[model samples]
Target: MTRPTLQGHLDGWSQGDDLRRDVASAVLALAAAGIRISELLAAGPLAGALATVRGHHADGDSQKELDVIADDLVREALAAAPVALLGSEEADEAVTLAPAGTLAVAVDPLDGSSNIDSNMSVGTIFSILPFVGADSLLQPGSAQLAAGFLLYGPQTALVLTVGAGTQVFTLDRATGAFLLSEARAFVVPETAEYAINGSNLRHWDGAIRSYVDDCQAGTEGPRGKDFNTRWVASMVADVYRILVRGGVYLYPGDARGGYAQGRLRLVYEANPIAFLMEQAQGAATDGSRPILDLIPTHLHQRVPLVFGSRAEVERIARYHGGASAMPERSPLFGRRGLLRA
Candidate 1:
């Protein structure tokens, strides 16, 4: 139960090691900020069980608890010297970090807003790009220098990478500093257990249906290995599980009108997850191409998503198979159509 030494980690980084130092510094500072914010929420006004409570939506006059908390956390992160460009999910416009700062930070101050009101395990996500000034905020995902998430559930924790390896740290309640709990490097299995929203099954496109049906098939389907499915409305929660355990998550283009491009935001959610996934030897795609490769035409850009274990993701990719016609009914799906077809 020895904690990772924060003092040494901070003091040891040299000027040449900007990425690690900044990541370590951000982890330390952000964990402190999260603790303060969580303490305030737990004691201040979050009455009743966490599952039942709800925070104000962005449309409301008063910003939600996660917004307030995220804003404060951003401020705390900027207070550290290295941060130069600050982009936040709560704010429409990006803020300048300083006259000439070293780090570009894109943050979803409070992700999973709907769950915030319900007291579900909502948290903040941040992506660090090595850029200065306003350009840093505008630059694409390929520019990311680091990315991570902070979970505000049973125990507060941080998982981040400065381009070396993904490392996970738990916040110490007593000290307000992070101690490495999991030495993490995740390589998703070739064939993945997948995550997708099942309710929209009626609206899924041929490609998506083909993919899901195969997963549900277990060994019976073309995939030799059995499959499992999980769906969490929270992106952080889903990504967190995938980072530790091998699996795939999909929010691909479906037949549904509103959810055609899928749900999660591009700059704040997809980009960050994509950056971290590649760092950990995982992959992220919007079904057509790598998530990180897609240029954002708008800030709140939405896109189809499929990510996690490499093999599983690749298999999903292969399902789309660039064929004009999707496999609507599998040869193995003969129980229903053998008589009809």
Candidate 2:
């Protein structure tokens, strides 16, 4: 049987509605840009020093050469689409694309650019929202009309949801088309796997540290089951793995100096990912609160992200709320545990 193409799916979804049609158009544009980026990434070093530091964002995150290039590519792709405002991680402020357009797009043109030199998986995450006026781009994640990500990995793939269900499509290099792979992807509610940066244990709050400690304790602990840990240091790669297999992922805010709010951007990163997670029967939160319900105060605002299997995500929230058992600290060491600074 022939697989349904992304265009076919979008065509059926839009039917003849003006807004849906424009959304479909914008999605196609993003896919086009993803294809180009996939080719460039496949070239590796042949594409020049893509990992070279280009500059720095106001938050001090290093801007990479390929980051800028990907931003340009995506912006160029959306130019002809019905996009009124473009909120991108690479841009300091939202850019006006089509003053009269009815859609606004928030995008992380190139996520995980640090993995460029290492040939690791990276991706582009996008959130499509209705243009509602000056605050269009600042709306909460709950207002998203559609959200998705293009993973440029061993096989380029697109995982998307348009308020229906999440779907996975893979690029057929020979046909140059995205073909349906998983029609209605759903996240498993329970998991024995998790992803996190274990090195930050020292900086983590009692809740995060307690959760990880319990997981690591295996069958001898509260969970009563062994768990495997995975961390790719790339949100897209890690989240994709959890979406496919049963697992949980956490990038929680710790006591570290510039990381109190977490590192991922709320609009382009967490929001889009949260939307996809919820659509796939998973869950996402900023520790104790739903990610989608949180209103964005600014475009580049960061938020702690914890998502994946619904059971695991809720358990995490319990940990954050102090309802879960926390590890004990010895009196000799006090609150500043001997192992922690």
Best by lDDT: 2
Global lDDT of each model?
A: 0.69, 0.91
Clashes of 1: 7
For all predictions, the C-alpha RMSD in Å is 4.3, 3.6
What's the lDDT for residue 70 in model 1?
Answer: 61
Residues 1-341, candidate 1, lDDT per residue (tens digit)? 67665445445543467566766566566666767656655553454232333344343423565576568766765677577667776776676656566777777876765666545676788887776545665567887777788887777777776666777777777776677777657866664467888888888876777677656666655554577777778777888888878788888776665667876778878888888888889998888588888877756667888888876676667667666435546465542211110
For candidate 2, the 10 contiguous residues with the lowest summed lDDT are 332-341
Give the poorly placed runs of model 2, Cα more than 4 Å off. Answer: 323-341
> Judged by TM-score, which candidate is best?
2
Q: What is the lDDT for 310 in model 2?
A: 96
Model 1 residue runs over 4 Å out of place are 10-15, 18-24, 41-63, 328-341
For candidate 1, the per-residue lDDT at 229 reads 78
Candidate 2 lDDT for residue 214: 77
